[model samples]
Target: MGVTLKDVAAAAGVSRSTASRALSGSALIAAETRALVEDAARRLGYRPNRAASALRSRQSHLIGLVVGNLVNASFHTIAEVVQRRAAAEDYQMMLSITDADPRREEGILRTLGEHGVDGVILIGTGSNAAASNALLSGGTAVVNLIRGAAESAAPTVLASDRDGAGDATRHLLELGHRRIGYIGGPPGTNSGDERFAGYEQAWRDHGLPLDERLIERGPFEPSFGSDATGRLLARVPEMTALFAANHEAVFGVLPALVAAGVRVPDDLSLVCYEDISWLRWWQPPVTVVDNGARELGELAMDLLLQQLERGRGSVPQARNGRTYRVGAQLVQRESSARPRDV
Candidate 1:
C-alpha cells in the first residue's frame, strides 16, 4: 500500500493537522516543522495527492505554453525558459505547438482550457486574431510573445522588434553603406510589419533614399532567402549590403551570397534580424539582434502567474492595452563592415 498522510505524520511525530498543513505548503506552518514533516514524508515515501490538493485549493498549478512553430529556435528557447520558471514556483507546464495555424491554435487553447490549465502563454501565430480573442474571453489569462500589430486584451510580453531592426539598419548605415537591401517576412504579419517598420525608420532618420528596387519581402523560408538574394543582386547590382528579416532566411541568403562571389564585409556585408546558430561561426559571423526569447518567456510566465494569483480581473486592461516590453541587443560581428567604395 502507498504511504498516506497518516504514515507521514506518525513518522514525523507531528499531529495529522500539522503534517497536512506542511504537505500543502501552508505559510502558517513553521519552517522547521514543515521541513521535518517533508523529510519524514520523503523517508516514508509519502506522495501528496494532486487531485485532493487541487480539489481543496482550486489550483491545478498547470500552465499551458502554446508555440506557433516548433521548428523555430526562438520558440524552442522560450518553451525551455518558461518550463524552468514555472517549476521554480512549484507549477507544472504543458506545451502545445500550433504550426502557425489559427484553427489549430484555437483547438489547442480550448483543449488546454478544458483540461484546467491555470493560464497560457502564446508565442507568435501569424495573424490568428480569433484564437487570441477566444483565449481572452474564455476565462483563461493569456500572454503573447513576439507579437506586434495584434489587438490583444491579454497582458503581452515580447522583444522590441522595431528597435532591434532599427539598430541593425543603423549599424549598416554607420558602416557607410549607401545602397542597402532588405529581405523580410511576409507583409501584414505582426512581426514582419514591425521589423520592416524599423528598417524604414532607419532610412527616414538618416534621410537616405528608400529604394524599392533594393527591397524584397516574402515568406521566412530558406528557398525564398536563397532565391531573393539572387533576384535582389540581379535587380540592384549596386546594393552594397543586405539585412535579412529572420534566421531562417539567412540560411538561404548566406549560401546564395557565396555562390554569387560575394565576400563578406568586402564584396557585400550581410546581417539578419534573428540570431541563429549557423550565423555564429560562419566565415563571417553574422551581425544580428538577440531577441531575448528566453527572457520574454520568463517574463511571460511571471505575468501569467500574476493573473493566476491575483485573478483575471486584477490584471487590468486599457485603451492601448497592457504589455511588458523586453529589449533586444545587437551583437556586432565580422559579417558587417564599410562598403568597398566607402
Candidate 2:
C-alpha cells in the first residue's frame, strides 16, 4: 500500500494535525515536529501526489457550497470570499442557491453528492438544522457560514445578529421614539429570530412595552419588505420609526414610505440590519447595523481549512465542534432621526 498520512504520523510519533501542518508548511508547527514528519516521509518513500491522495480518500477537492436567499447582498460578499479561499487552497467550489427552501437544499445536496464533492459549506439564515444533520451523518464534511447546523456536526461562523439588532432598536429608543415598528425577516431564519430577540431585549431593558402588532415578518426580499411595511402601517399608522432586518427589506420599506408621502427621518425614521453598497449613495442614505459580512466570509474559509486539515485522516469527535463569531457595528447615516412630534 502507498504511504498514508497516518503512516507518517505513526512513524513520527506525532498527531495527524502536526503532520499536516508540517507538510502544508504552516508557520505554527514546531521545528522539531516538522523535521520529524519530514524525515518519516522521506524514509517511507512517501511522495505526496495531492491529486492521487485526494482521489484515494474519496475527496474530489471540490466543495459544494450552498447559499440561501441570495437577494441579501451579504451572500454576494460571502460568495466572493469563499471562491477566493477555495482557489487559494487549490480546491474548487460549486455554488448553488436554495432561496431558503428546505426541499431545495436537500435536492441540491443530493446532486452535490453525485458530483463527488468531498465537503460542503452551507450559508444562510440557519433554519434547516435537521437537514444539515442528515448531511453530517452521510460523512460529508460540512461547515456553516452565518448560519448554524447541528451542534454535533460542523463548525459555524456566526455574525453578531443579537448585538446588531439591539443596537438598531436602542438607537431608535434613544432618539425619543416610543412607538417603533419592527419589520423582521422570515420566521424560519435564525437571524430573524435572534435580531427580534435583541429588539425585545432592548425594549425591555429600557422599560418600553413591546407591542405585538408593531412586529411583522417579511422574507429576506425587497417585495416582502414592501408588503410587510404596508401591513404594519395599516395596523399602527402612527409609528414614527422602523427597524428593518436587512438591506433588501430596507429598500422595500423606504420606497413604500416615500410613495406614501412620508418624509424620511422627518416623519418615519428607518434603521436597517446591513450595509449594502448602494446605501451610501442613496438620496437620504441609511443608518444600519453592519453585520461584518466580509470578515465573516474570510473567517469561515479559515475554519473550513482547519476542518479539512484536522479531519483528514481520522474521525473527529463531536466535542470538536468549533465556532468563530464576528461582532456588529452600527453605522450612522441620514435615514434615522428624532421623532417628528418630539
Candidate 3:
C-alpha cells in the first residue's frame, strides 16, 4: 500500500488535516508548519490522490494546448516551452494537433471543454470563433497564440511579425539591393498580411520604388516555395536580393536556388524569417529574423495563468483587445551581401 496522509502527518507530528492542507498548498497553513509537513510527505513518498483533490476542488489542474502543426519550428518551440511551464506550475497539459483544419480545431475545442480542462491555449484556425466563444461563455479561460480568431475576444500573444519583416527588408535594402524579390504566405492571415505590409513599409521608408512583379504569395509549403522561386526568377532575372518570409517555404526555395546555379550573397542575397538550428550549419549560414518563439510561449502561458487566477469571468474586458507581442531580432549571417553591380 502507498503511504497515506495519516502516515505523513504522524511522521511530521502533525494532524491529518494539517498534512492535507499543507499538501494542497493552502495559504492558511503557516509557512514553517507547511514546510515541515511537505518534507515529511516527501520522505514518506506520500502522493496526493489527484482524483480526490479534483472532486473536492472542482479543478482538474489540466490545461489544453492546441497547435495547427509542428512543422513550423516556432510552433515546436512554443509547444515545448508551454509544456515545461505548465509542468512547473503543477498543471498537466493535453496537447492537440489540428493540422490547421477549422473542423478539426472546433472538435478539439469542444472535446477539451467536455474534458473540463482548467484553461486552453491554442494557435487558432481563424474559423473557430464560435467554438472558442462557447468555451469562454462556459466559464473556461482561453488564450489565443500566434493566430487570433477574428470574432473571438480571447487574449492573444503574438510575435511582432510586421516589425521583424521590416527589419529583414531593411537589411537587404541597406546592402544596396533595390530589386528585391519576396516570397511570402497567403493573404488575410496575421503573419502573412503584416509581414507583407512591413516589407512594403520599409521600401517606402527607403524612398525606393516598389516592384509588384517581384512578389510571390502562396501556401506555406515547399512545393509553393519552389514554384514561386522559379516564377520570380523568370520574371525578375535582375533581382539581386530575396526575402523568404515563409520559413516552411524556404526548404523549397533553397533547392530551387541550387538548381538555378545561384550562389548566395553573390548571384542573389537571401534573408529568411524565423530561426532554426540547421540554418546556422548550412554552407553560407543563412541570415534570419528571430521571431522569439520561446518568449511568445512564456508570455502566452503567463496571460492564461492570470486569467485563471482572476477567474475567467472576472478578467476585465479590454477596451480594444488584449494582445501581447514579443519583439523580433535580426541575426546576420554569411548569406547576405551588397549587390555585385552596386
Each model's C-alpha lDDT?
Answer: 0.81, 0.81, 0.89
**Tens digit of per-residue lDDT, candidate 2, span 1-342:** 888888998999999878988987779998888999999999998777767656766677887779886677888998888889898887888889998777888788778766667678888546555555565666667778876755435778888898899999999999999989898876656687789889999999998788999998767778878888888888998999999885568768878887778778887888888788887877688888999999988887777777677653323454645777899999999989998788
TM per candidate: 0.86, 0.79, 0.87
Clashes of 2: 0
Cα RMSD for candidates in order = 2.9, 8.1, 3.0
Candidate 1 on 1-342: residue-level lDDT in tens? 899999999999999999999987899999999999999988888888887777786667888888766556787788888888889889898988877677887788788877767788877564655565565566577887776325666766767888999999999999899888999887777668878999999999999879999888887678889999999999998989999876567778888998989888888888887677777888878888888877887788878888767665422355434777889899999999999797
Local lDDT at 146 for model 1: 73
Best by lDDT: 3
Against the true structure, candidate 2 has what lDDT? 0.81
Q: How many residue pairs clash in each candidate?
A: 0, 0, 0
- In candidate 3, position 61 carries an lDDT of 91
Better of 2 and 3 by TM-score: 3
Worst 10 residues of 3 by lDDT: 312-321
